[model samples]
Target: MTLSSNVIKQCALLSSLALFSLSSAMADDHTNKPVVEQLVDTLSTIAGPHPGIRKNHAKGIVVSGEFIPSPDAATVTNAVHFESPATPVTVRFSNTTGIPDIADNNPSSFPKGIAIRFHLQEDTYTDIVSISVSRFPVATPEDFLGLLNAVATSGPDAATPKPITQFLASHPAAKTFVETPKPAPVSFATQPFYGVNAFKFTNKDGEVRYGRYQIIPVNGQEYLTDEQRAAAGKDYLFEELPRRLQQSQVEFALGLQIADKDDALNDPTVVWPETRQIIKLGTISLDTVDDNGKQFAKQTMFNPLALTDGIEASDDPILLARPSAYAISFGRRISGQ
Candidate 1:
């Protein structure tokens, strides 16, 4: 079944509260860090041409100057299946901060990332899962909104720091990431994609257990330093994604970890540690590349709420916020009523 609009708003509100609460408690901890330095390092490492908003650029991909869907999938670990959900997907490639026509490769903005996803799945997992390229994910949902608004309003001087700084001062949750998030990887092939949500692993008998999904990348991650990225140009992430596709097959193995249901629910901030073991489930391989157009390349909306059967969402606030945010942005783009 499709997600309801009411649910989406609630998720955003709850995430806002959670992140705000986290930030309020850390004033002393992050007071020493410079917000500008943090933003510089934080935004520069995003991977792809689009950062926060999915602007409907699903035309396809371009590799080595050829257009296609990124052809390096066959060798991707656990990438055993290939099927399109066929749900209409809109991909927008742009930045979380900066005006509509601004170049995302600017060192001052966040790097690119894809939001590819399909509509609601039949008997799909109830638990939602959304992950950012960085470890802390984001400190608050309002921060996300700020990102969108920043990009929407960016102009000469590109001084996005003002609004964000004001927001951090007003919202405690925004303070949590004062140390700077690690940033999204420059190449999706190298970074591990996480299900990032706690789930219940059920048995045929209806037994249940807590779990997490891990998309293990075949390569190691590489990030852009603020200085290096500034000199690279606005389309750096876009250039990198296609560059890797031309070299070889790109693959990621999907794995799951069964953790304690109680602990899993209580601690959304901690990773359940790989020593607990992540069971391999499947793989996703994009066998071609296409730089044809922004519609084909960017705006592909991927929501953790858009799931298949056999998995589920936890009570985690962050996981729940994605479906709502994704739905709002997606619904606005599609059914433009």
Candidate 2:
């Protein structure tokens, strides 16, 4: 019998909650180091050590743009990005893993990263960091570390069930992430990105709503077929994006998928149903790139938890862990480690 999407989400949520509780207890007993440090360590183990660079999604192209907010944007939040006029923006599109030159078409580089910096008034800024996947592979930082560790330990010569297989056998969400089909996009401009972690948005009246962000391509979604993927170059996305921009600006609509009363806010592994209301917050137009913008993208750290007002992060451990992890990366990069 085929199970419904809601049933699948509920089952995933319950499993994730149980795993999160158990992982927290184990973490409290086992390690004294901060979860962010552990997360970085595990990522390094999987991706190999790369000093002075981001632990993952190290290779990227930077661009400049403008965020044109919708009139109804203030209805969801009083955040400056929504209430203010069109703001300048900086964006980066990246591949997965610490290997900076990893092939874009490699299966390992499935979920591309999209990091945006909304330049608000008075030198203040808000950031949105998302990936191509709608839901995260694991719900908690502990499980995320475990997943990385599992992959690091697994190989053709590994004994018994193999580390990754054993790990996935117990974690249905992680298994789903591994099994999910991630086709290569024709270009970064054609891909849709999603913020897996839910955040609370508060309007001027102080009414709060939980939602996840989605960047829908204004050009519509398009993916390369297996044959086309095989024919693509290693750095196709990086090369194609700039070439495409030379012709015209690339655009995407910034949208927020508001959660229902029963939605699992803390479990990012549980994707909210499509039936949920989505509000178009703004349009992001990537027009051009200059030396300064490229340098800013290289130097600046985009932290999802870097909120202004009227917006707050959820209690998800993965969400909580991001800022510290990003700090570690930023420090290493700036200090020339």
Candidate 3:
């Protein structure tokens, strides 16, 4: 079953109020260190130390692909990839959490991730980072840190209505996120990924629009039934992607969910109505698995803010802070910290 729209909106309101009340207090505590460092520290605290891999979404598989833009793609943005011929891409599919060896079917892996790197001319490139869920829990970097800290502090015998539970109580979106049932996908090729932040797209004509990304599998979204999930192996998702690629190329349609003038552009916690327009951008066809998928993923930093001409980052604080956070994680793994 899915949550009703009314419930989600109400929760978003409650979350906003709760966050507003706690903002001043949190401001004092987070000043001693950079928010990015705090972010890294909180994530490590929650997931424990796992050197040489991503701090989050550590278990992932990388694949090589090319993106073929739709003719109408140029109508939305003047971005090179949208107007040029087929562009080469490096795509990675990953599980949630920092445990590199987490089981494919683990509940913690519900919100699977996909990060795509669009290789443009002159060695420049852009990236899109997304997850299975359409909406994120918090809207700001500080709130995200608070969420992480709450989870990290909440332990077995911590207390009734633990820190995490109390934190979720005040944040409706986070509550909804935690309560949502996310089943395991039969294969990475069968799931859909949605962008968490909105971007401002400018066309050659200088017209601008705000939109979020949506990458849907050409095969459509398919999840394993309870019976199938129970019988699946620990490495099912990772193993299945390679086997599926050998059978045929894995394909997905890249789309943009255009927002109306009144839509909240900066807040990721708000889920736009389903009736909004979704503009088809292109098709992504992945054929080969990276020879050193793990090492390649560790070395690559898929920054959502690493955009090219014609695409600009919105004023979303979470969106703006991502590049710095990712840089810290990349540095740690690259230097073998």
Candidate 4:
């Protein structure tokens, strides 16, 4: 069934209510903040305050590029970026959290982010926001917020049985997310980024397929050794990317990991099996790092839900909540709040 945008929004609201109900029952005096507000607040607590900026993924470098579609791209989807002559693109590579100067080797910097804006016709655009991790820690927005709350409440001086430890005990996927090795990348261009949420793609024949986006670096993956990590500069990624670009363009192939009939469509925390077929859609060629591109990236807000025809959001609550949360971040940043 074709899911409408309104249906996705309602699902997100319902998920929020479910989360609030469960958490409120556990606590005597739970704050009645909106889901978006709670998300911002919890992330702010974890990442510390960064006024007039994103609560997470605040540190980034923007670059300009082009998206060259593969010949068979149209057979899988009719997304505008895959149709043609090369389309201009703007992208941001960011570290996790609000600390703009977090060390490149910090474990907190795992699941690095890549946000892409495909400049389509008529000044319209589509965004694909992804992270280095294949799976997310929580399946729903409620669980995500709960995890953050657990972290916030379980500080160094908290009572016996820390909240985070309790949280991890209950959420195995979250525990796995924490336990997973997230090695520092040699460069942003070398890391494989995955869209943890699934999206529906429609082809010219009107056939719909549910899949996750996997952006594979054309240059192959490379990671820093333990010794290299120990001696790396705090801003190593930011410093390395531009120098790498000066030598040659950075590129990655945009591929979709097609979901099986029995795959969990609504859970971002569950990764689809690698046995599924992958369809290469296009190539992202990042050629230049300029002040203009940087300014544009800073001003632009990339939303995964900002989709065009033939491309639609799945029922994933995390995916549904993103647009609203992004709007809040964008508004705060632009207004200098």
Q: How many residue pairs clash (N, CA or C atoms closer than 3 angstroms) in each of the candidate models, in the order given?
A: 56, 0, 0, 0
* lDDT-sorted candidate list, best first: 3, 2, 4, 1
lDDT of 2: 0.82
TM-score preference between candidates 1 and 4, better one: 4
Residue 227 error, candidate 2, Å: 0.6
Question: After TM-score superposition, what is the CA distance of residue 80 in candidate 3 from its true location, in Å?
Answer: 0.6
Off by over 4 Å in 4: 1-29
Which 10 residues in a row give candidate 4 its minimum summed lDDT?
Answer: 20-29
lDDT of 4 by residue, 1-337 (tens): 1124323443444444445333432211476656666776788888877777777888889988899999878988887778877999888999888787787778887789999988888756788999998999998777888899998999889997999999999999999999878888999999999999999999999999999999999989999999998899999999999999999999999999999999999998898888999999989999888676444544666778778888998988888777666665665665665
> How many Å off is the CA of 1 in candidate 4?
34
Residue 163, candidate 4: C-alpha displacement in angstroms: 0.6
Q: List where candidate 2 sits over 4 angstroms from the true fold.
A: 1-31, 292-294
Q: Candidate 1: misplaced stretches above 4 Å?
A: 1-130, 134-173, 183-186, 203-207, 225-227, 261-275, 290-301, 335-337
* C-alpha RMSD of candidate 4: 5.8
lDDT of 1 by residue, 135-197 (tens): 333434435445433433444655756655655566554455444454545654555545555
Instruction: Residues 1-337, candidate 2: write the lDDT tens digits.
Output: 1123323433443344333333342344577655666676777677777776777888888898899999878999999889878899888999988787899999998799999988877666788999999989999877887888788889778897999999999999999988887889999999999999999999999899999999999989999999999999999998898899999999999999999999999998999999999999999999886555444544666778768899998998789777666665555565555
Model 4 scores a TM of 0.90
The candidate with the higher TM-score, 1 or 3, is: 3
Question: Between 2 and 3, whose TM-score is larger?
Answer: 3
The lDDT for every candidate, in the order shown, is 0.43, 0.82, 0.84, 0.82
Could you say which candidate leads in lDDT?
Answer: 3
Better of 2 and 4 by TM-score: 4
